[model samples]
Target: MTKKGDQRQAEELDPRKQTILKAVVDDYVETAEPVGSESLLQRYPLGVKPATVRNEMATISDMGYLHQPHTSAGRAPTHRGYRYYVDRLAEPMNEDEARQIARRLAKTVESQPEMVTATLRMLSGITRYAAVATTARDQSLKLLKCVVTPLTRGRALMMCAFDNGSVDSHVVDLGSALSAQQMRRLNASIAKLVEGQQAAEVVALKLSLPVVEDRFLQDAIARTLRAAQSSARVATRGELYYEGILKMMEHVEFQRSLESLEQVLGALQDKHRVYDAMEQTPENELSVMVGEENPVPELQNCSMVVARYKAGKREGGVIGVVGPARMRYSETLPLVQQMARSLSGVLAKLIEE
Candidate 1:
């Protein structure tokens, strides 16, 4: 989600202060160490006296941009500081990099799942952080086929297969015996009626049909609708895939123990939870939830950078990376957006195919 501007409205930063903020974030991201005014002066030609830089650092710290980790250690950018850097100061991804990413994806990806995996892998590899993609979107489910198979003398199973390659089946008690001819007619009727219909449309079942002479097949068709709806309800819970969890472990933030890493992964393992985080951010806008800004305590020490990617023309999915609060937002943010564009193209092509 885009950062809300009201938080920064209390006191508009001067141009010099913005430069200090950007320098501090850039240096910290590079070194993963606290940044001091002296280092800023040495690395950047700020044209400000050392004392003035120190004073401004204190002012920005008071404004919640920078924080001193220890009395002896230099100050570092707070979550608010990262927010300001992303919204106002981060550099755009140059065309050369974007074109390179396009060429790379075009050569390697050949299928929908491959494209999704490649995008998450690219994000994880480049950001050097845990990356996640929610691959199963419920809205993308469309009826591919519906069939009824006899289970016993008076019972059968109604099965519905969707475009996403998911199958859902429900047992139907026939009550009366269904002959082979009767079952064939019922399956043909259902296949014809649900040919291009969505799950909801299948459930509604507004189909023009000849009067069914077979009572058992009539009951079976009614039960098939229930089975499709059940599948639709089950699909609301999407599947989650994660990569580069070990990359996250290398960061100092997670080096103390494996507990933090475990907690973060456990929290993210739930597809619905991660999907909510992605959707909770502004639609079609890249969002950066830094450190304590994250709603879940497990992610309070980390950051979640996410955006939605279109799945063909009608459906969409979530993609994101998780790393320490001190992240290369300037580098990773644009890369994630780039990977999403490539993945969207792959999905659109699959839809066409």
Candidate 2:
């Protein structure tokens, strides 16, 4: 069925059934156990007797929203049930929590790598799930500046700064030291050759100079050019940051089966697959995929809350939280939204400044 048809069918569920499903999902998320009518009556204000609630639960199960794991066990939500519950969640983020998220994000170091690391740490710490983000490589990123610093007797470090607020560095072995005048002349030569070139162009670009009599200057220029090419290649590829994998393993879902855990870990290890999954969500919007809704086979048993954040006016990237299908959607949604907002704001400011 189409998404609209699926939504309409979910909406057609009676009000009482919706309430019971919400309660069961909430309780299951909290305790990771099957919920029965007796437990619902004690914890939630369901205005019905035991017989009525049990009958309703049975009917909902028949419709495939809830599943009975064992013949004697109570009902837990199926993937369909989680989908319905997530679609209907209406809770808004708390004002205090929003302020806290903003405050923490503002304190992140104003560099690309540091900002990504701090954002991942805060996300995993708040959600207690694995947090992953990928920064898209901009082919048109211009090489704004390049600095070459002489290190030991035979080594030098070359740092290249890009227009997108990212810096790539390389260390090269220089055959001989360059004099002050030669260094100045070499810097000028490099700036003229490659400073305004795009990262994609620089990857295949060759740095050349008019004939210079000094062999030391010739060798130094050659080494720096090769290092610049390496740095350009680094700049042209996307960057992936992932954290909290070990922490995610502490959840009971993964502990249930060694094979399941291995499968999930293996899937996440593939950067291309993870990037493809994130690509399904549109830019500047938050998306939730629960259980079977996930496209990746290993992730089908899991849930993901993903959001795309703007890095600059024309640049964007994806950030996400991954956990078991029984994740607390009500809380995860707002947290992911806030993190995306903060990340976009910080990145925009960094790019501008």
Model 2 lDDT per residue over 227-265, tens place: 887777667667778989776687888888888889988
Candidate 1 regions with alpha-carbon error over 4 angstroms: 4-10, 140-235
Count of backbone clashes for each model? 1, 0
Question: Candidate 1's residue-wise lDDT over 263-311, tens digit each?
Answer: 8777776655666566565557777787777766677778888777887
lDDT of 2 at 151: 81
Q: RMSD, each candidate, Å?
A: 9.3, 12.1
lDDT of each: 0.76, 0.81
Q: What is the TM-score of each candidate against the true structure?
A: 0.71, 0.70
lDDT (Cα) of model 1: 0.76
Question: How many Å off is the CA of 277 in candidate 1?
Answer: 1.7
Error of 2 at 284 (Å): 1.8
